[model samples]
Target: MIQTEIYNNGPVEVAYQVYDDFYHYKSGVYYHVYGDKPSGHAVKIIGWGTENKVDYWLVANSWSTTFGENGFFKIRRGTNECEIEENVVAGLPKSSGNIIGGFIAFLALIFYYMF
Candidate 1:
């Protein structure tokens, strides 16, 4: 599971389909279920927790602090909401030197397809 990956590693990057509700999201656990048209977007899943019995994944959005919860938001976990669980990418560098290069390559790949 993605949660397992996060526990073993660190943050994971996920590419998912975003709807109108996601753009306007402010606070609380977000669970997307409407039929609004979706566009491709990506975010980093940094952690997870349960709020009021609702399991959620804490994510860092690229949209900046003006966005949801100071650039972080919680989404429903385990259900693959917005197919966020799909297209997940994570890697552990073999050495400290490779970390920056590896991450830059990953971001370049993501931006290549996202734009």
Candidate 2:
């Protein structure tokens, strides 16, 4: 479902459970298999592709470019890896044939999350 949304829409916001190993993440496909007491974290999955026979979701993290793969990382796709597939949210601006309307829609989404 997340993949489908990305294919049709664009980036999708996803809330994930972060474990201890996530802090050490630097490069390559991230697949957390162990650790306990995961904290909540959110990231945007902009796209997906296969790498070295491994399917992954191209995710953009908020930790800045100094973090994983220039602030982006690939995580094992499918199988609900780290429950990332769950709690997916996506929205499309209602096309009112005007730029202001579109911008308002975008702002509304931000406000929805803020409040």
Candidate 3:
């Protein structure tokens, strides 16, 4: 299931974030499909940013809006802008070339546990 795929990335950082893929769609999420299995979607990539305004997430999508900025979703930061249902900040991808991301994540977990 999508949960397993999301969990595989471990507790620190996630490659994708699992969400109910039946309704909500936005930037940063990737859809998963398997033979005869119920598929779910996940938010791919973490620590990545866009040149757009910080209040919104510049997402690239496969929708018909491909001709222009419509191909993307300006997801509200610190908030959810859902077509039907709002999504939460599920997980984030570690930054590319992030040799120390794992270490930071580990330290974060330790710090969380200690607190």
Note the Cα lDDT for every prediction shown.
Answer: 0.85, 0.81, 0.37
Worst 10 residues of 3 by lDDT: 10-19
Off by over 4 Å in 3: 1-54, 65-70, 83-115
Give the clashing pairs for model 3: 17-43, 45-93, 46-93
C-alpha lDDT (0 to 100) for residue 57 of candidate 2: 95
Model 3 C-alpha RMSD to native? 12.8
Off-target runs (Cα >4 Å) in candidate 2 are: 95-115
- Which one is best on TM-score? 1
Of the two candidates 1 and 3, the one with more favorable TM-score, higher being better, is 1
Candidate 1, residue 50: lDDT: 97
Best by lDDT: 1
Scored against the true structure, residue 84 in model 1 reaches a CA lDDT of 86
Q: Give per-residue CA lDDT, model 2, range 8-86, as digits (tens).
A: 8899887777888888898888899578835767789999999999999999999999998999999999867878887
How many residue pairs clash in each candidate at the backbone level?
0, 0, 3
Worst 10 residues of 1 by lDDT: 33-42
